[model samples]
Target: MSNSPSRSVIVTGASGGIGRAVAERLAADGMSVLVHYAGNPATAEEVVAGITASGGTATSFGGDVADETAMANLFEHATTIFGGIDVVVNAAGIMPLAPVATMDLETFDRVQRTNVRGTFVVSQLAARSVRAGGAIINFSTSVTRLQLPTYGAYAMSKGAVEALTLILARELRGKDVTVNVVAPGPTATPLFFEGKPQEVIDRIAGANPMERLGTPQDIAETTAFLAGPARWVNGQVIYTNGGAA
Candidate 1:
């Protein structure tokens, strides 16, 4: 891994949640990371600060992942600052739950634009820009397989992401750039705990064989594997769900 520090990554939604964890983890693996946030610069800066404090290489950038122009600029900035891009992680997404029968059209569209369009924009850029031996990782939910209620729109959007990732991996054949998805079960991020009582949380936790919720680091570990050492693990969905499905 002596050549690892020369590698740089662009991680969308690095302001918090799994994205932040990924930024920190990848930086620890000796990669310079471009931490991106959609709205909160302060949070993103904190992630940057933490990495630098630990003697790691990282910086923060902000943009709407759904905007091709903005994302292109983000890629350019990462390449300019880090010398070149090696990996791209599309962790920016929004999940608003509403049953399809009563789901607001506006909310549904917003979900599609941010989750589906955002992943598309980032993955498209990564396909063209990421260096060989790199990886493009997209986020999806185990809910797609679990078929949970009120996740119709969110799951539908991610279904498209799964399809996109699989095909993009093939399209990049012989390019040495791998494409994959990380579908996590109930993770214990603050975002996950929000608005949920202990009973609900416990019930969800008990459903899994792990008998607990996954931490951000759990997902990040799997991502680090794909980004660094798992070259042959291409074009697949690695469910980091503790066998919940």
Candidate 2:
């Protein structure tokens, strides 16, 4: 393994969930990491602290992923501080559920702005900033395939993400940059567990042949693979869903 500390990465939404796990995993892999948070500075700091305590290099950054200016600045800062950026994981997002029949325009817009626009903005910046041999990993959801009720807007946003991922990979043709998306199914993050009853959760878990919920670490390992050794896996949507969907 060419685990080089000179390699640096930016992981957005690193304050919690899969983002945090990616940050930690990259740090352990000898990559300096920038832990980014949308609004939770404290959680971001905690991640940074933990990495540094374990002798891994990491720092915290804050920005709204959907804000072009903010994202641009975040990229500039990462490049400036780390000498150059080798990877970017756009893991920041928001998910709100409402049936399409009764879904408010405001809620739909909110989902689009954050999930779709945020991904577009981050991917654009990453395309321009990442060095050759780098990877740009974006987040999509397996829900896009599962097509669960009340997830119409979310699925639509991720469908767009799938489009962006494949197109971006082709566009980066000679740059040695791989663009891909990770679509997780029924992860056990606080976000996934928020309001669902145990019975509901159990049913969802059983839908997958694995018969269990996925952990953030499960997704993080894939991010590590793509960011480092999986150079040939370009423009692919690797489903880290334990065979769900």
Once fitted onto the true fold, the runs of candidate 1 whose alpha carbons sit more than 4 angstroms away are 1-3
* lDDT of the candidates, in the order given: 0.92, 0.93
165-229: candidate 1 lDDT, tens digit per residue = 99999999999999999998989887788777999889989888989999999999999998898
What TM-score does candidate 2 reach? 0.98
Q: Pick the candidate with the highest TM-score.
A: 2
Score candidate 1 by TM-score against the native.
0.98
Show the colliding residue pairs in model 2: none
Predicted structure 1: lDDT: 0.92
TM-score of each: 0.98, 0.98
